[model samples]
Target: MDLQKQLNEDMKQAMKNREKQRLVVIRSVKSALQNEQINKGSDLTEEEVLTVLNREMKQRKESLHEFENANRDDLVAKVEAEMDVLHTYLPEQLSDEELQKIVDETIAETGASSKAEMGKVMGAIMPKVKGKADGGQVNRLVLQSLS
Candidate 1:
């Protein structure tokens, strides 16, 4: 994974600065990447590495939400910190407008006219927006369009 080099550099910088939380996150990312490499039996492409980072970020966000609801300020803070570090590696998220346009275009392309055709629309849209947009966001917008 080419991004592995960048992660190594960032980890070195974090270690030099004595940033414990940041270093932990970076190390976890490295560990995840290594595991993925072993599973695939080859180095991952940048996109595949991104899929791992994105999954980590999503998990952090969900934990943050649960912590907030449970009044666990301390855990919420930790999750948010981890999320901030992970965000640096993730691709810039698409704007709502941009995502909506893609959904509209996909709807047009797939000829999905009603809610029942949601699967077909999603099948066509996910590949177009993969890694560029969140699946949840695309699902919501597609639901709106079909409804």
Candidate 2:
């Protein structure tokens, strides 16, 4: 099933099981997806849905970091749980070695020999890794490879 359908099914299951945290996360993602669809004035493609999922995951991660920094153990645990819920919808993440290999290959393909050509390398590689990798992680790998 597609993400929206899967989420809807999961939401119902969560409700049935009284899984409040999971239910809340699912509802939040569904809302974000619906808003994006409305803004675009069309149904979201799989890729677009992934983009929204990734964005929500990223926000949760940022919140996790902030909570950790502020020593708010309660909030940190809550955010971590939310992230876990969100992660279930994302594609399996790329490993460091795999990401590096792709970065090296894209560099060669783009003939990007210096950091100045980082934009070229990023542009060529992102589509290939989209939704399967975090943009920040990919950017770090690309920078390391270029440097």
Candidate 3:
């Protein structure tokens, strides 16, 4: 099913099951997607939907980190739960090995021989790995490859 349809179905299920945390996370994601649609004045394609999901996940991860640093176990648990809910929608993440392989191929293809060409390498790689790999991990691998 398309993500929007699946989200609607899950939202109904969450309501019926009284899964409060799941419901809240789903509603927030739906709200974010709706806001993006309004800003663009168009319905989102699947790729755009994934972009929104990734953005939400990134936000959750950042919050999770901050909560951990602040020693707020309660907030950390809540953000972790939200991250778990968001993970259900994202495509399976790339393994480090798989991402490294792709980075190597992209560097070779783009003739990016040094760190100075990192931008060129990243521009070519992001679309291929979008929604599957974390940007920081990709950046680390590219830097490792270049140096």
User: Cα lDDT of all candidates, in order?
Assistant: 0.91, 0.94, 0.98
Give the TM-score comparing model 2 with the true structure, all chains together. 0.98
Candidate number achieving the greatest TM-score relative to the actual structure = 3
TM-score of 1: 0.95
Estimate the overall C-alpha local distance difference test score of candidate 3.
0.98
lDDT winner: 3
TM-score ranking, best first: 3, 2, 1
Query: Residue 33 in candidate 3 has what lDDT?
Result: 99
Better of 2 and 3 by lDDT: 3
RMSD of each: 1.3, 0.6, 0.4
| Residue-level lDDT for 139 in candidate 2 | 93
How much is the lDDT of residue 117 in candidate 1? 97
lDDT of 2 by residue, 27-135 (tens): 9999999999999999999999999999999898889889999999999999999999988999999899898899988999999899999999999999999999988
After superposing candidate 2 on the true structure, give the runs of residues whose Cα lies further than 4 Å from its correct spot: none
* Model 1, residue 39: C-alpha shift (Å): 1.0
TM-scores of the models, in the given order? 0.95, 0.98, 0.99
lDDT of 3 by residue, 89-142 (tens): 999999999999999999999999999999999999999999999999999999
